[model samples]
Target: MKSILFRFLLLYFALQVIPLDIHYYADVFSLPGSHLGYRGLFVLAHYTPRFFGSTPSFADWLVVAALALIGSFVWQRRQPQPDWDRWRYWVTAIVRYRLAIGLLAYGFIKLYPLQAPFPSLSNLNTPYGDFTRWKLFGMSLGIVPSYESFLGGVEIVAALLLLYRKTASIGALVIVFFTGNVFMSNLAYEGGEYVYSAYLVSLALFVLSYDAYRLFSLLVLRQPTAPNTWRLALSRPYLRWGAKAAVILVFVILYGVSAQRGYRHDPYQVPGGKGIVTGFYNVSLFRIGRDTLPYSAMDSIRWTNVVFERWPTISIAANRAAHIDASNTEAITAVSNLDKTYESQGTNGRSYYDYSFDTASHVLRLTNKDPRLGYDTLTLRYDRPDSTRIVLSGLSPSHDSLYVVLDRVDKKYLLEEAAHSGRNNHQLKL
Candidate 1:
């Protein structure tokens, strides 16, 4: 029974380390020099095998368990080892490092506040009911960045503790609590990370099992517990510290620096480049082919509000139904500005567009960001008559000539207002 358990775990963790996706290797071979930014971080974070589908699924685990069971049988038949203690120790080390690196990859992103970015202007104005459960969960964390950073700090500390053999149990204990909460939250919020979180929790449990009896005896039974003294001696200095240092260099230092640079320069979730004008504007006048439509809450065809983000993105609020993009996973890296879907994902209240402002021609070419909504594009020419007012004339997606007037809204968010008024020191006005 002991040998069977060890063999099964060895096979399971080996499968966990090896990337089974063909595309993962393709990405590895197509590396463009040493410029591994967020792209590299993603390659590390999403290391688990996905033989069944693109996203992590429980079906894959079930298959893996079956395979491990069969392999243990084969392993026992082919070669029966006299001692399994040394082999178990080494396999546990592999799992410990894998969990440590995985946690670090996610921790750095959160540490720098890039994982759940601050809500955009459009997100702020969206109705509460318009957002999906996963979006709401992320937004709640995004709003309190300090809290998010604290969580990241905890994860980082745990990962660091995991590198040393003596402190691995402590790190595993921390992860059992922290990542267990994450797993439950994902299940409750309809998030896409429940599978991945459970994977981490499993690894933590395996590591914790080594010292579980000692802890039980010390804490529960109120008895003297002997410390774990088994240590594998590496005679060479390179064998002892070199491997550990390399792991730290790659996982912590390199990944952390890259995450910081990404946050400072180009946030992966946010579209790149600046917009011509950025503000919230009220759709004062709406005209479609010489027919003027009065503002009505029930009018699906008429635009109510338009928001120009700092990036090359625009969001329009109307009564029209929008197809929600339900992808809640990490936006590791976007190939183009149009491919960045973090802002539009899990929201159905407004239409988001990736727009290019041709300042030379005074034209705006807008394409729907949500692929589920189909490829709808609009070409409009703008005229800013004054500082507060603008007029747009062009063809709509339906090939109808359209004329619209926009009035800049001097809207202030309470969160921003409180920040400016020093919420910690001064009483908030509202």
Candidate 2:
């Protein structure tokens, strides 16, 4: 029974260690020797096999588990069982490092509040009902940066503990609880990363099993528990410490530096800097092909509210269908204005556009960020007569002549107000 269980676990986790995703190899080999920095390392650390899809899928797990089961049976039948203690140590070591890398990859992003970025102007003005459950979960975390950081800190701490042999069990315990909660939250919120979270939880549980007997004997039975005395014998001193040191240098130090740089300069989710005009504007006047249209909630063609984000992004609200970019994972490396789709992901009732500003000509060339509406492009000439008013003349998505008058609302958000005045003592004026 022991030999069968060992063989199964060995084969199962070996499948995990292998990069089944074709894109993983593409990313690995495509990096230029000169540009092989911490960014590349960070990307490598976060990799999960995507044979099924980009995100970890249940089908992928089932397939891998089946294959591992088949391979384990073959191995058991073909060869005599090796030293169980020695083999288990090596397997545990591999699992520990793998889990540590995955956790740290996510941990660093959240520690700096990059995973769930602060809501943009459009996000702020958007109706709560317009956001999907997953987006809502992320936005809720994004609003409280400190709490997000705390969660990241927990993951990082657990990951650090996993790096050492002595505290592997403790780290596994932390991950089982912490990542288990995350998995549950994903299910409850209809989040996309439930499979990945469950993957981590499974790894944690495996690691925790090493000390489960001792813990049960000590805590549940109120009996003295013996510490695990078995340790892997190393042929060389360098192999024992040198390999561990290298892993730490790469995953912890290098990845951390890269994450810090990302947080300061290029936040993965939120675009950096403010646009020429950044604010929520109420669409006071709307014209479609010289036809003056009054604002109506049911009118799909009439503009309602327009939001110019801090970046070169615009969101125009209308009674129109939106192609929601419901991406599962947040550990994205691409930071282009178009690629920064978190602002539009899982959002509806508004059309998001990535625009280029021609300061000399006062022309704003807008391209729809949604892949579904990628062909929807508009050229708008803007005139800012005052600080609070912006008038735009352009062709609508329908290729009709359009004109819009935008009146900026100096809306004071409670989140911002609460930052200055204590949340408990803030006065409500809205």
Candidate 3:
């Protein structure tokens, strides 16, 4: 237990818990961007010979590795292997507590269907080839929200189990099996959670080692095994109560409240609507420059159809070549829900825009959601002649004079209908 390897492992965990997730923490407390200034901290992190990259995980890992290497060397000369039973006990307590916190956060997000939200109209209408494997995985999960919730339930159960010493082994086992699968899935799908997921798996494996021999003797050899009855006791009353209070406050109150608010207000995944009425609209007329192009299949430049989402997004299906943001890397807490240009992400079939409307002025402002080109804006005058008809006319971003009219269509999607009315219900129509 006092081996160099054990000390090194402990040091790694210590380093990992240093709270380097600046962006996540900033977003969590709704702190101003300047508060967690990357520019200011750049020097300290750079001394990890560091990188203040977009994702702070890599930077944190680098810093920890550097510190661990130095720490191990210093400890090697000083203690030469000191009695560390007390340290181990406390470390184990910290690991289990931290593990519980991580699982709960992830579990709640999935439980509320916020991690992989229901498919947006834009996503359903998009070409299959357009989505990266990771995006496809998320959309596939989104299709079966019940299954997503089931996965979350499993995580939550594991978290609850970890809170009790008797059940900590079982909890660790669950985490290993579950997070192991998660790690593999992330690798297979090119998902962004690989590092963090693997990090949890490592912690779980360490916790499982406590009961590994007992389990092996009992289950594998069919031998009588004695359970570990040694209980952890705190020497100081304040320390014991303080630790418990801190865990509840940070893990329960802070993370729980944040996740709940996110589920209701600004979930990571797209919710039912944004800011516009969602529907498929037929492009009744198209005018560009002095040429009024008829609705001809061969006219690639003319839009065939348009889709307006309840969100602040619109999609136009045209043969015109569109730039797509195909990178599979994921960024979290970078923008608000209203500003999430989701329709344009991992989509190739149509041109999408994040739009805002001034109802009083009868004007619509649109910004093309192509991250590659920087958002391009278009200001147009709009009129709703009736409940089903919408007309828009103005100069396009290209400086070309244009006009377009849209007719609303009654469209039903199988997935959503299945959700509104239970799939097993006989009376429900597809």
lDDT of each: 0.85, 0.84, 0.72
TM-score of each: 0.94, 0.93, 0.84
Clashing pairs in 1: none
Model 3, 305-403: lDDT tens digits are 888887777888877766666545433343443346544666676887778888899888888767666777889898989899889999976689989
Superposed by TM-score, candidate 1 places the C-alpha of residue 133 at a distance from the truth, in angstroms, of: 0.7
- Which candidate tops lDDT? 1
Highest TM-score: which candidate? 1
lDDT of 1 by residue, 351-418 (tens): 99999887888999999887766757999999999999879999887788999999999998986676
lDDT of 2 by residue, 253-360 (tens): 888888888788877687676688888899999988869999899898898999998788899899987667777665565546776788888888888888888889
Comparing 2 with 3 on TM-score, the higher-scoring candidate is 2
lDDT of 1: 0.85
Candidates 1 and 2: which is better by TM-score?
Answer: 1
lDDT of 3: 0.72
How does residue 175 of candidate 2 score in lDDT?
A: 92
Comparing candidate 1 with candidate 2, which one achieves the higher lDDT?
Answer: 1
Clashing pairs in 3: 46-50, 274-310, 274-311, 275-310, 275-311, 276-310
